[model samples]
Target: MPKVIDHDQRRKEVVDVTWQLIVEGGIEAATMREIASRAGFANGALKHYFSGKDQIIKGAYERSLNNLGDRLAAHTAGKRGIEALEMFMRFTLPIDQEDATAARVLLSFWERCAFSPEIHGGYDEHLDSWKAGYLQYLAEGRADGDVLTPTPDEQLVDEIIMLNIGATVVRVVSPDHLNAHVLEAQVTDFIARLRRAE
Candidate 1:
């Protein structure tokens, strides 16, 4: 008998391929043919898993969100409050090449949103989930009295999120132009202001 493929696994395989195609070749190079070729599948094989390109792209967007969420969960395991916040930030900011590729693919997904409402909606949901989790983290830190900064500025924390995203984008576009050491210091200091006396 022919090998039976796991449907969900195959779907993710297609999305994983979609991610690589976009990352290595940019949006234009992510045509269906390219994805299939790069994925080492026959032409139109992706269709068995996805109805269209947007379907797969949306899946990849969710995968990316889950990817970050998983990393943050692992990084912040057994931690809480200010430490949790720092761990979250550390998982987000580009400290190495592997992290940078994930960051870069994410930015590319944002640009893809401009052209597809499906993608835009998917991206928005993922971002809102992240932001909501962020708000909760801040609120919990404050309640725990472990929040180090002067109380907490909700707007400022949101700005910090933006700063993180913007900085990572720069690293993606101009790898040589970005200094991880500088970014690390800036981010660490920013989080430092949020700590309470131990």
Candidate 2:
């Protein structure tokens, strides 16, 4: 037999290398040649996996979003209402090295989204998904009487999503200003302000 390859695994490996490059040195560093070399593939081999660097970048970004979604799903499983929502938000905070790396990679992609319509479209889809998730959680909290901000459902959903994204970006850029405790406190206060008065 010649050689069997797990195409999905190979593509993921390439994407991992691309993410490493971006996390270490921004999107500009993730050239196809560098990605192939770092991924232990010939230059031409990367083309077989991805048409070009842009495709690789997009793949890496989508991978990041998928990873985040997986983690959030894990955290939110078997939980509902405010507890699940809080858990999901906590996972997004960049308190540790792994989260910081994720935040950096995501921020780097945000810049690319400005110019790449493909990336922008993917980002829009990812963002829309997040907003929808938030809406679900918000509705759950309302049903359970855990949320009482009196804000419009759509408005609350948008605010929550914006707050999480803004905090992630700020934590990535100035972690010292938003330490783990600070992040927790910020979220806690935000959530508390949504509670109905006794």
Candidate 3:
């Protein structure tokens, strides 16, 4: 019998290789030929799994977002009020090697979003999810009397999103300037300012 191939596994492997290339040399480095070589696929084999480079990039981007979402869910599970919000914000920061790696993959795709409506739409969807979660935790904190800030939940959500996105970019570009300690301290202080007096 001819050899049987697991298409799903091969596609995932291709995406993983693409992610590594992007992290190493930005999106430009993840060329189809290079990805196929790194992924142990023939030059044209990637077409079997992905339509082209954009599709592979989209796959890698989606995978990165999915992984981040999973981590956020795990870290915030059973936590509520300020605790949940803090965990959500901190995890979005590139405070560690893993987070930093994810940031690299995400940032590589950030530019492409401007040129691709599909990718841009996907990003918006994930961002909306993040905003909703922030709003939920903020409302919960208010109900529990943990949050005392006069700022509207929607405004706070926007601030938090901007803060995290800015921090992530800074951390990726200048890790020395925004070291893990500094990033953590910034997030802690931001959350602290919104908490009610004990």
Residue 165 local lDDT, model 1: 80
- Which digits, one per residue and each the tens of the lDDT, describe model 1 over residues 110-162? 77788888678776776677677667777778788756566446774687679
Cα lDDT of model 3 overall? 0.87
Candidate that scores best on lDDT: 3
**Prediction RMSDs, each to the true structure:** 2.7, 1.9, 1.8
Model 3 C-alpha lDDT per residue in residues 1-198, reported as the tens digit of each score: 999999999999999999999999989899888999999987798888988787889899988888988998899999998889999888988889998988888887887888988678888988898899899999999998889988788998889888878877887787777888988898888888888453
Per-residue C-alpha lDDT of model 2 across residues 84-115, encoded as one tens digit per residue:
88887788777667888888788888888888
TM-score per candidate? 0.86, 0.90, 0.94
CA lDDT, every prediction?
0.76, 0.82, 0.87
Task: Report the lDDT of model 2 for residue 3.
Answer: 100
Which ten-residue region of model 1 has the weakest summed lDDT?
147-156
Best by TM-score: 3
Q: Could you tell me the TM-score of candidate 2?
A: 0.90
**Clash total of candidate 3:** 0
Q: How far is candidate 2 from the true structure (C-alpha RMSD, Å)?
A: 1.9
TM-score of 3: 0.94
